[model samples]
Target chain A: MSNGASGAEAHSRTTAVALSDVNITFRLADSGSYTAVEGASLEVADGEFVAIVGPTGCGKSTLLNVTAGLFPPSQGRVDIFGANLAGLNRQSGYLFQSEALFPWKTALENVAIGLETAGTPQSEARARAQDWLTRVGLGHFGPRYPHMLSGGQRKRVGLAQVLIRDPKILLMDEPFGPLDAQTRQIMGNLLLDLWSADRKAVMFVTHDLEEAIALSDRVVIMSAGPAARIIGDWRVPLTRPRDTAEVKLDPEFHRLHRDIWQTLKAEVMKGYEQTGGG
Target chain B: MTRGRLLSLQFLIAVITLLAWHLATTVPIGGVTLLPPFFFSNPVDVAARIFKWFAEGTIWKHLWVTLIEAMLAFVIGSVAGVLIGFWFAQQPRVAAVFDPYVKAINALPRVVLAPIFTLWFGLGIWSKVALGVTLVFFIVFFNVYQGVKEVSPTVLANARMLGMNDRQLMRHVYWPSALSWMFSSLHTSVGFAVVGAVVGEYLGSAAGLGYIIQQAEGVFDVAGVFAGMFVLAAFVIAIDWLVTLTENRLLVWRPVAAETRTQA
Candidate 1:
């Protein structure tokens, strides 16, 4: 709405991805079904950076998977750029939580595969992939296999692999879940740098609230699951081009953090309790 | 550890074994022969027979015949394995339906089929190829199947997310994965391919190393049998070496245990 002045149909037009009253219930092996998310509705405006944050197993990833069309929501609609999503969201790039790289391919080949599959010539795709790899600070590591690289290095390649295709929307599910704290911050900043330069509709799901606040324009929260639903939404007031680590020092950042924590605390405690933890 | 030193050491070991064989066959112990020459020919006699065959060029025809049969079996069997393996992997229903039959066939000792193959294809190279195909097919089929099954789900999902069509997914995701497993099982399949050919020729064939060995054994020529076995051993070793070189070239991407550790 802020970007679009056109009346009536502007909401749907401006929206890059919309999930309306989605209910994802997975059928268990034993004839029973478990509802992971229920009545979840959210809209990501074109080029908007929205992060979905929640406690562990609160269906944070389920929402992203729904957006990705990895599986359909049991009961709702998913629209990509106002068009109904069918088999897959062709306009969106997905960064899986675990290692998704083809182990047999070199870093360059993995990054270029998206382009190659889309009918780009090998030479052109290879050139563009090289440029993207350099953007991710891995120009010389092109020949290395995924197993030869460290976790952080592999994450960089994954980023390049997804980004080289220039997807209109980015669907990330805990992209930094496996990294150490320092590497996580580094990756977060790198993500912001790339996203800021080429704005894309990003739905980043993470359990780390701090990460959600640092990288996203708006932070949305979900309660603990067996029917998890979005409980709160807050627009981050921090200015643009902010460093992920340095943003934490601001007073406004602390105030926003405190407010969200109070609401998140109960849900997090409930989440932990559900998992048989304290 | 150097290449030259390793080769010499291996040659020295071979010499010692031959020396032991010669002493056992030729030398008398307390005026009694430990290993009779008629049963176990001396190494020198076996060596001379091998030299004589090669020098006369009489072995080339049989070697060529056996190589042709083995090569045909390997090509046909591997291609069939790969095609069927991909089909079964992509179609779960088909795989499930054929599971019992597949298990039963694979469990049966395939050597028994040599006679049947000879009957169907005749006492020619085709029979030998058919026998070899039976041996090589299952080894490659299982490897391909395992390869496709073990492909990382995340990698497959990522490929799908890249907007790759079914054909592209097979080329990008499945083929390379399955190829790796197939290549890893190469030596076994190759050995089986040769074994199949030799066994078939032994059962009913006019040509091939197996035929010559059969002829020698029928005549009670122990030295000829020993010579034939040594040649077969050398031939197998040469093929295995080629396989190793091919594996190194193709699987260069595989992480070598010590040399290519995960880099930070």
Candidate 2:
């Protein structure tokens, strides 16, 4: 691709992530293979905030993992900033939905490890890790192990762990899925505050419709799986510096939510039906 | 339930049991001894024998020998176990190839290996240490394998995302995880190490706690046999206490479910 040539190509060159016609299939333990996502294509522009909201088990996380180069899509291509993706997308930082913090390490050490592994000296990495901890409102919690922290506090540390590395693309898979409603709202605000300071292309995955609309610049929806596809893409018209709680009261926010939900409701029911019996 | 009350209750049980034993051995009931002193050796004589051994400092050398053998075995076996365990865990193909062989070896009673070890290493401390190694190895090896497996996939994925290479992952993630698992079985493995040493020494050795018991048994000294057994029990408890301390130090990050209850 030679980093492309023309002005239009140059503009496309600024694309932070472009996954074109990606298909992901997983081989089972038996002599079988299951297709999760088929012909899935989406692009995240530089500094754009995008949320992929879908029903549970709709292979939404699989799509994010594909973007991260966690595994190659079985039948399609992944392109990062005009370069063909190969192994781990080095320019990205991923925040998993599960408990990923090393239980044996303190919060500070977990945050510092990224830099340390990249050859930064211990003193400098720890100092910067402390700064990141402070930014995430966990300045004094550096010494506490992951088990000792509350769920909300641990999420804060997780956020710090990713943000400390300052990756070009931040891939989050339901980063607030485990927290309570109140705590999720608080974390949503904290995430927006950090993203605003140093904007990156973020691909956030969640099932919470209200959350998807509240925090994102655009909302991407997916249909139910066994070859799930991106079904809808809607731009949120609400302005930034928007509080997650206050934005819900906006009539425009309601309109956008109503429109996205209309296309999403059928898929949500299908997902539930698939999971209902089992 | 309270600490002081529990301690007093435990002390009371011991005193009651000793009193019963003392009365049973010395006093005849219905013109026949309840527990003949020749067989049971009365609690008083057993206690006095233990006291005399300590007071004369004659038991220290043998105790030291057994402790040395057990400690060496523990160190060697645990190290080898951890290394091999890591090897088997990370390399699935190797693990798969060796799977049946590992199971077969583990299935074999470790005690049965003692005679062969003595034949190979002779009747010196190395043989006892070798025997102890066999006993300690499997407990740690299986635990370490489990620890590596028990490492949350999320944690490993996050570490990879954080840019840890294979060696770094081994150090920060795998080692700590395996070590925690090893510590969980600390009491069992340490007790096995002592058992291995004692068994090796008992079979045929010049000196050790086991040898002392063998020597006294050869002379038909019942009190001495009882005294040797008591000393071994006490020795094991002391080593177990030290294991507990080491476990506490190494696994401070491990969540203790009863920690809050115990503190309160």
Candidate 3:
């Protein structure tokens, strides 16, 4: 653990993303308002992996969007590396819940899009894209377009596109949420492997408890909402290079899971009530 | 060899049609000339008249004139259509504001504009070219507009996240997405180009196949009309082939319906 900490600190300055009393609201067409997220405050440490778990409409996605500088908070402030993110488009990588590959470009070209837009030479960008594709085990598939690829293959290409840039902070909104269980497990492990090598500050949004436990150093659980708020924050004590399967068998893992689930269960019931599910 | 087979098929159909016509005309089953010599003339006579036209330099000269008019109109119309369509697609509010006006113009009987174009541009090839451009432009424009509109939102978001500026997005994303639609429109527009050119010529022209056909009609020479039509059909087929070849080359990334199944 000390070695892992020292390594992360040595490679890059820990860039903290702090959200102070952030409130976000949306206006409905018919003279009413909806509060997606209200008074949500959280901080993600640099070189840390934080997972957000919540019921549907709890504004987990909205929180990530604010963090990415995609949407402005109606109230409060978001700071990245101690710099305010007010009307400023931060250079952060975002992986949507969907694979989101551009159907027109070949996998290699899609991956190189970031570098090309940043003014890198086409040939150099392509070579670097190829290198990243190989890292994600899609070297031979680079020439094929996204529509030609299977869902799993497309997801890997999407990851490669984001990974190649090595952005200061990564915000993923249910990146593996759509994959089949087996594929999801494989992708989860792949993400951990990638992160182990270069531990960038990552904010992952998911509803899956096991996924949250497997990937995050900390888990932030949100209450159900007309106005959602963070209900629990658990610091995961698992060591680095952790085997997802092995971690599940650990006694501490079960204890943490139980603790988090107990907090979430009431919120889940309240979510059902709000949606008229009762 | 394929050309040989095509010609043979055409010959066989021609022979069958000629036999039916000859029997109908000579048999005199009714008092009416059901297969009139002045209107539905004998196929053999039409073949001989076509040979005479070929000898008189009538075939090559008029065919060349019509072909040039059609090609020029198609090029001008398609280029203008693509540019305007892309521009309109980028500005949704402007597109919405003018959409009904554009549709109103499209719905207006374009054939009626033949005389107006002739009056505006004189009775030269320019009038025919103008008419042809109007006919082809709307077809291509509508297709390209719809194509650009239907670009996947997910893909656009992904491109934005990847740091693609508006120019790069337009070049890589919008163009490729709209290309197949543009090609489909081009195929249909080829036929429209010929219609516009021939109709404009028929309305007011001293030259072109349409002029020859009109003269033949005035003289009760049915075979000449058939020969002119045969030449027009050949031109349409040739242009269609060119469009197909270009489509195949430019759209190599697009998998054919059959290829998609195989990949699956």
Best by lDDT: 1
**Per-residue accuracy of model 3 over A1-278 as CA lDDT, tens digit each:** 12234334433654578899989899999999999888899988788888999987799999988887777999999999888996434457888886578776789999998899889999999999999999988999999977788788888999999888878788899988888988988888889899889788889999898889888888899999878998788878777788776778888788889989999989889898889885
DockQ of model 2, rounded to 2 decimals:
0.78
Q: Which stretches in model 2 have alpha-carbon errors above 4 Å?
A: A1-13, B257-264
Off by over 4 Å in 1: A1-13, B1-12, B257-264
For candidate 1 chain B, the 10 contiguous residues with the lowest summed lDDT are B255-264
User: Which residue window of length 10 is worst by lDDT in model 3 chain A?
Assistant: A1-10
lDDT, candidate 1, B75-133, per-residue tens? 99999999999889889999999999999998988778888888899998999999899
- Which is the better candidate, 1 or 3, if ranked by lDDT? 1
Query: What does TM-score give for chain A of every model?
Result: 0.95, 0.94, 0.93
lDDT of 1 at B198: 88
lDDT of 2 by residue, A233-270 (tens): 87776777879999999998888888899989999999
Better of 2 and 3 by TM-score: 2
Residue B133 shift from truth in candidate 2, angstroms: 0.6
Task: State the C-alpha RMSD over the true interface residues for candidate 1, after superposing those residues.
Answer: 0.9
Fnat of every candidate, listed in order: 0.83, 0.75, 0.50
